[model samples]
Each structure stands twice: as C-alpha cells, then as structure tokens.
Target: MAWLADAVVALVALLHVYILVLEMFLWDRPAGLRAFGQSLDAARASKVLAANQGLYNGFLAAGLLWGLWLGPAGFGVKVFFLACVAVAGLYGAATAARKILFVQTVPAAIGLALLFGARA
Candidate 1:
C-alpha cells in the first residue's frame, strides 16, 4: 500500500512537470497550441502568462518531490501540496475548462486517498 501510494504521488508530480513543460517551453509552439486549443496569435499573446502559470506548476511539482524526499515524516507536506493542486484544479475547471477537474483534481484526489489509506 505504501509503495502504491508513493507511485501515485510520483505520478501526480510527473504530470505537473509535464504541464509545466507544455505551458512554459511549448506554449507558443504547435503542440502547446493544440493542447490548449489556442490560436497561434492567442498563444503568442499569452506566452508570458502561460510561462508564469508553468512556473507555478513547477513549484507544485517541486513541493511534491520535497514531500517525497522526507519519507515518513512528510505526510503533512504531501497533504498540503496535494490540496493546493486540487484547489487549483477546481478553480481552473470553473474558469477555464471542466476537464481540468478530471485531469488535475481527480489524480490528486486519488493520490491523497491512497496516501491516507496507506497509513491505516
């Protein structure tokens, strides 16, 4: 159970890192445009904003990784970072796209549940 929880947490972190890449390095490129459903002009116009968002995602990933590095004592850190991801996802779903709930929030929720359940 612990191993499974750890894997889920790592998966969530990797997803965030991927998001960071998409938003930061690829926002103005075809792949990012396609992913975000943005026109080239719109993507170009918002490149800086997307990069800022990407940096936030990177911070989330870093937090998750830091929690992982702390081993058994990292429960509170994991919960906090996972909650942040869940809230961000919820906000994005409301304002940007509903799929954000499933993409970002669901995974974090699952990871959270697994993390908690593993302690039982």
Candidate 2:
C-alpha cells in the first residue's frame, strides 16, 4: 500500500513536470497550442502568463519530489503536497476545465486514500 501511494505521488509529480514543460517551453508551439486549445496568436499573446503558470507547476512538482525523497519520514509533507494538488485541481476544474478533476484531483484523492489506508 505504501509503495502504491508513493507510485501515485510520483505519477502526479511527473504529470506536473510535464505540465511545466508544456506551459513554459511549449506555450507558443504546436504542442502547447493543441494542449490548451489555443490559436497561434492567442498562444503567443499568453506565452508569458503560461510561463508563470508553468513555473508554479514546476514548484508543485518539486514539492512532491521533495516529499517522496523524504521517504516514510515525509508523511506530513506528502499529505500536505497532495492536499495542495487536490485543491488546485478542484479549483482548475471549477474555473478552467472540468477534466482537471479527473486528471489531477482524482489521482491525488487516490493517493490520499492509499496513504491513509496503508497506515491502518
């Protein structure tokens, strides 16, 4: 169970890292355009904003990795970062895209469950 939880956390971290790359490096490219359903002009115009958002995603990934690196001693850190991800996912789902709920929130939720359940 602990391993499963850790795996989920790692997956979430990787996802955030991918998001960071898309937003920061590809915001004005074909890949970013398709990912965000933006036109070339729109992507170009919003490149700066996307980069800022990407930086935040990078921070999230870093936090998750930090937690994972701490091993069993990092339970609190893991929970905290997972909660942050879950909350951010919920907000994104509410304001930007509902798909974020499944992509982000659901995975965090699953990880949370495994973390707590494993302790039992």
Candidate achieving the largest lDDT? 1
The digit string of per-residue lDDT tens for model 2 on 1-119 reads 89999999999999999999999999988899888889999988888999999999899899989989999987888899899999999999999999999999999999899999887
Q: TM-score of each candidate?
A: 0.98, 0.97
Which residue ranges in model 1 land beyond 4 Å of their true spot?
none
Residue 87 in candidate 1 has what lDDT? 97
Top-TM-score candidate index: 1
